[model samples]
Target chain A: MIRLDGVGQVFDGREGQVTALEEIDLHVRPGEFVTLIGRSGCGKSTLLRLIAGLLPPTYGEVRVADEPVTRPRRDVSFMFQRPALLPWRSVLSNVMLPVEIEGDKGRAAYRDRAHELLELVGLKGFEGRLPHELSGGMQQRVSLCRSLIRDPQVMLMDEPFSALDALTRTELSGELQRIKMELSTTIVFVTHSIEEAVVLADRVVVLTPRPGRVREVVDIDIPRPRSLGRNAHLTEVAEISGLLHGLLAEKEARPVDEVRP
Target chain B: MTDTKRSWLTTSPVAAVLLPVVGLIGAIALWWLATVVFGIDSYLLPGPQDVVSTFLDQPAYLLKETGTSMIETVEGFLLAIVLGVPIAVLIVRSVILERLVYPLLLMVNAIPKIAIAPLLVVWMGFGQWPKVVMVLLVCFFPIVISTAQGMKSTPVELVELLRSLNASRIQEFFKLRLRYAMPQIFTGLKVAISLAVIGSVIAEFVGATQGLGYVIQQSGASADTSLAFAAITLLSIMSIVLFYGLVLLEHLLLPWAQETR
Candidate 1:
């Protein structure tokens, strides 16, 4: 339900224009879990922003639901690297934010849905507690509950688990796969962890850093209800991971002048 | 670790109340000794007991003056909160407003508020209006600066998150930005209340018929140093109470603010 065509982004650096992305074309089908993976500065987040319509691309188009994205759509929810909960609000109130911002029209209606989502994320009793009162992982789960409460068409996550510890990250990634299976919502996630991408994503879009360009797209054909153990099919994961690594290594050996200066 | 302590002085409601009182007693003891050792005349610096006697001797009159000062302080502070917050919103919402007003704000705050007190008396006349205005002047800047800083500091990711939901500007401001700014605004308020007390007192020093400021000034001229000391103590008490009042309000209103920090 989302597409980007020949997109480019240029940020005004102190010296001159610094290219963040260029000639990037990506298409995501509805209900698809797509992960964009690359080293830092590969414009994974820049691409996410384009899809969210947070910034106007220097050149090209991003569209969702076959509509040219000019501004943020109410049907798209964005999750940041940080949980980004309002510290002054209770966990329940923070989850209810989208409902509150959209107004009272059906807020009373969504309150129950919010509670259910919190329960889905294992944060039921935490509803009355503040965000900080929760652990970092719990806080991010609350953020996930918040993003889903709107029944959004697309959820864009920018390195949501990057700041988390390894155990928490792995645990959350496993849960995210289950959540996706249950919710059946489209997600375009950004992350650096190959294991996380392998576990959660149906397809991984790898990009070249510095004027980010789509280097390759690796499809994970592994069967679902996937996890770090049992059903993940680690052998298939390892082969695909090695292939992706070779693609990155090939470029790293070259040391392209464009990337450095 | 501190929570496990059972000592009466450190573990109960008594501990919470006793610590500051102990500090006060120590300070009083030091002052008493200083006066005895220096053999200073009471006219120059009255001992703590002398100040207490002044308050005890004319309790009704002193309290009446305190009431007047309290009215001025609260009014000025409330007005600062009401006006300063909105002005901060305006500054944050518009780059033009921020550009035009921010430097001017710095200039206004930089100018000694005491220097303006005499001017206020000249224009506003020898009445409570001058004192209120002076308090507003002193208190207003910190509120605006801190609130604007808070609003501006609303994480870019959160802004993008709200934007992804297509929240209206008003919705973004009221729901996200304002709440994000609460702890910071309270910090400004805590700082400003103390300044507001001083502002009103300074205004009173230039010209006023009532308030503890006027009482202290009157006592100074009459060489009633103990009375002046009492007035100063009342002023300090008012300042401490006002500062802690904001702390209490912050505790009640933004319980979540304390956690993340």
Candidate 2:
């Protein structure tokens, strides 16, 4: 569904040019859930922006379903770490935002769908309440409902659960998995948590620190509707976790620009 | 009863009335004591009783002038809100426009509004229009500044989240940015209301034949200190009333914010 060909991002800092990512090539299939895992400043977010078409890549091409992405695609949606609910709007209104903006012709058309999305996200009675009135977890849920309102083909989530508490994060992770199953939409999730990557993604693509490049892609043999606590895939999870730990430690030992060739 | 107690403490009705009432009583007591201890001339510092008597004696005149002043204040204030909010949004949306126009706005704001009163009178003539323009000038900057700041200060995470959802720029502005800016916009409105009164007074001081400012100026010339004080007191009353009106609106429109605050 999405492909990045030799994509690179460079920042023209006050000091000098800083490369965030270099020679990044990847292909994401339809209905695939891919999580990008790396240390802070590994350009995971930069890569997500490239896919979202929010920023132009300084090098190479980013394409969605064979079309070059020059700008944000209508069929792709992005989610962020923060809930980012509008404090002044009710939950229902927030969810209805994309429809309203797209001029979806009639309000009645989107109303039922919005309600269903809210119900799916477990925010039923909260339709009348404003964002600030809800708890942080609940606010994030509203954001999730909002993102899913458009039913985009691909969902790009950048550390969507990182700011949430452990319990809420766990809950949302499970919910996301369920959502993936129901919708079967392609998703590219970015996170720092190894457990989060393992629990939520089919393939965890690990990258090295700044001037980020793919170190490895670890496939999770975990079955659907997976839980963090207990699963038949716990042993596989541990093995992947151990592998990621080794990569991280090795990367930390070397200077950022020094490759392990 | 404990639940009621909790509700009492948590709600705005009790705190709003109690705090302000206490403050007013304290202020009145100080004023009365100061007059008594200093044996201040009633002409220089009329007691609350004297000011009340002035109001009682010329109720019709005070009411008429107050009504005129309020018309000018409110008309100008509403215009400022309409004009300021859009300009603020534009400034936030376009960096080039913001850089070009914001400093100009700041320059206009920095000029003591009192100085511009004469210029406005000269341009608009010694009529109600000048006073209205004056009020607009004084009240406009804070509204624009607060609104622009409010709009710009939208949480980065929320913005990123919206972008990830493939929300168009216009969608992000109206759905997320505007809603987020509302509480701060109300802050601007409250500030503008008080300044509106001041602006009207300044215009009256410069050139006006009606309104509370005119009443105060005319009373000053006649050396009727009590009447001038009466006009001043009425001005204060108008200011307080307008301010609370905005507060009431914030309560109605943004109950969520009020609850959180």
Candidate 3:
């Protein structure tokens, strides 16, 4: 589990001091799929960085599993918008990177796990291929396998599938939901797509633009294998998407800080 | 049949190699025609046939000089790679070091290498040391710059991923940054090898008892134009061989780097 208490971040810019996030509070339960949705510069990514302990909050505290996070934790993994595979490494080598960095003592133990994860992501024979040999979607899948190879307690995904094509994005979203069920890991995924937030998250946390604040947390009461157009709860998916859209529209009228301060 | 058809296209490996070879032969043919038609003296621009015959006239002596020059080139180039990569690591790892040392590197790189050749001879004497040092000087800058740029160009997402794993500073560098920078380092090495060949030639021009450059100079004084042209031709062959040797090494070491794009 991850917890943020009154977390705020202010960055010094060339022009002046700039507020990226303010008076934030968030909690992600174990094995929960939570997605943060907002427009660019909403500080959604900044918040994710704080949770992953990649950056410290300027104000307040972030705790993971009841421990105050002063720095990154070995049990947390982060995925990026880009696959970020090393061009000189094959897929298997790229997936084995963390193990290599940590030490080779458990290399044999984790090699099988890496291969299984690769297979789970539909990249079985691709272990020998380079990142460039694959399409964009496939590259992202390799990254997914890489993140899962560590078998971490939490996964922080920052728009992991946004760079993919629309059809691939939809397909990956379904696959991600399945991966979450199989992996049973806590996840805090970030995206700008309302539909993506609706389809993938158990709870969608929407944030207001610049100097981001949690505008609303909409719960999706849909079963697994959810989709934008083909789910058993298709009507519910549409309703939740509509609700998220309205919340974003409401943000245009009222500044979150002004309303809640 | 399809392979044959495709091999004739612009992007085929066969065409890729053959086109350049054809162009080079055409250029030599044009030069030979110009000399014969204009009735130019062999003392000016000797014919290609005249140059080739000069190489045949004293193969042992000319080959020995070439071998000597080549040894210096390789020594200096290898030294630059060994020293320059670590310097790049230091600059990338420590901000204080980068701020302190980067400007000095730039200043040294900015000075014309030809200007340094005489100073090197004064300092290191007329042996192979001066030439080796000169090669190091010329090749060192591009190696450091390219390596540093490659290390710095790592995606923010990958850095965060490594951070989330709570990797040590050393691990972050050796595993992630260094691997990511390799394709680029080979790029630097390729560039530096060519410059390495040029550097030895400059050092020889300043003062040398033997080398392709010395042979060329000696021939120029004696008005043996064919031998001078022959020496120049040998220099070009040396540079071409060294450059391609590096390209081949890159292919072997980082097959994945080439596979992507």
Candidate 4:
């Protein structure tokens, strides 16, 4: 339940004003997994920041749960591309960080949830280990556990698994699907990979770069637990991925000046 | 045989301690040999044993002076941390404060600390206060610079994550920024501790009636070169001990930091 109406972002640059996004409208349904995909400088991340309330849009409004968002809402959580674990904190403590910041009186309850979330992500015995002791994939898993620890109404993930190896990325995508089945949280993910977008998203929103604007929103009819390898929906996955790839390639071919206006 | 020896030197726990001990003994032996072979005057370079016997001659007196110097060093170090860290936090939190204070701090730091030692004595008298102030002055810059740099280096993703969760500024600082900055802060601490010992000695050199630095000065006047060597050795020992103490503390407190590096 997130909505952005006519959202735009413009940054003051050393050269002049730089438009990041223009006349954007996007809505994410509750329990839905939406992935935003485009090339670099597409303002994909800028768009996410606007929704997270880390930045205010130059024009238009963002609403979450039917309320205008003037600042970050407690019921919304964001995940980053990097693991971003506190190097001094143990895995459990890092996961418990959000709750600690909230100063919640019910810490014991959150602690239990933290442990459960860690186990859900196959990090059961890693509670005492430091973030650096783990592999990159494992560290990202810790980050995921942290984001999910609060049980937020919406989770905004900005390419959370893009840093991992291909095999790990695929594995994490499947695990993410499993986790999504168990939780009703809406998710808005940003990514560079078309296959990742296709496999993970209920709907993939493709944006055009250079003052990013929504080019198309493609809905996937594929069943859950989608895989990149041999699966029942392999053809469908390839078809959608190929379509998005072509769309993105076509955008790149168009002259930069033609798209500027 | 060489390969096995090399591996043992690296892999065996005993080698870890034994190797450094061997190196130190070799250094001492070289000094003793040079004094004997060259028939070097003890006035210029006393043998290690001569220095040791000099310490034995008045163990109580030397130890008392050592204690005084140690007190000055620890006190100044503690004060530096107490003042330096908060100033760094203030600098990081506000651009206006950074702009106003940064150049001033640089100018203060740049004016050779030795040049200010006499001024400190003039202002605070020839007591322990001057020495303590000296230590604080020398130790302050490294702590502030390292900590400010560390706080400013927090990953943007983590900051965004906290913002999306509606974290307060204080919470973002204490929970994310400060914790993340700790490894670098400890780096500053280690550097400052060594400087702390030297700072106190420099102040003592200017006008103190006590401390190892004063002992060295007195020995120089009396042509008791062996005693001066003893005091110099003790100062080195103190600096080494304090530096390693911080290293040990960092190991215990931030085991994760070591792994990340």
Q: RMSD, each candidate, Å? A: 4.1, 4.2, 3.6, 3.4
Model 4 collision count = 0
lDDT of 3 by residue, A27-69 (tens): 8889989999988999999999998888989999999999998
**Residue B189 displacement in candidate 2 (angstroms):** 2.4
lDDT of each: 0.86, 0.85, 0.88, 0.89
In terms of lDDT, the poorest run of 10 residues in model 4 chain B is B1-10
TM-scores of the candidates are: 0.89, 0.88, 0.90, 0.92
What is the full ranking by lDDT, best candidate first?
A: 4, 3, 1, 2
**Which residues of candidate 1, in runs, are more than 4 Å off?**
A230-232, A252-261, B1-16, B29-49
Can you list each candidate's DockQ?
A: 0.69, 0.51, 0.66, 0.72
Interface RMSD of each: 1.4, 2.4, 1.8, 1.5
DockQ (0 to 1) for model 1: 0.69
Model 3, retained fraction of real contacts?
Answer: 0.85
Give one digit per residue, the lDDT tens place, for model 4 in B131-232.
Answer: 988999999999999999999989887787777767788888888899889999999999899889889888888988999999999999999999999999
Question: Candidate 4: what lDDT?
Answer: 0.89
* Sliding window of 10 residues with minimal summed lDDT for model 3 chain A: A252-261
Per-residue lDDT for A118-194 in model 4, tens only? Answer: 99989999999988789999999999999898788998899999899988987888888899889978999999999
lDDT of 3 by residue, B1-261 (tens): 556555355868888888899999999999999999999998998999999998999999999999999999999999998999999988988999999999999999999999988888889888999999989999999999899989998877677777776778788787778877988998899899999999999999888999998998888889999998888999999999999999998888877777654
True contacts kept of each: 0.85, 0.57, 0.85, 0.85
The stretch of ten residues in a row with the least summed lDDT in candidate 2 chain A is: A252-261
Q: After superposition, how far is residue B118 of candidate 1 from its true place, in Å?
A: 3.6
* Off by more than 4 A, model 4: A252-261, B1-7
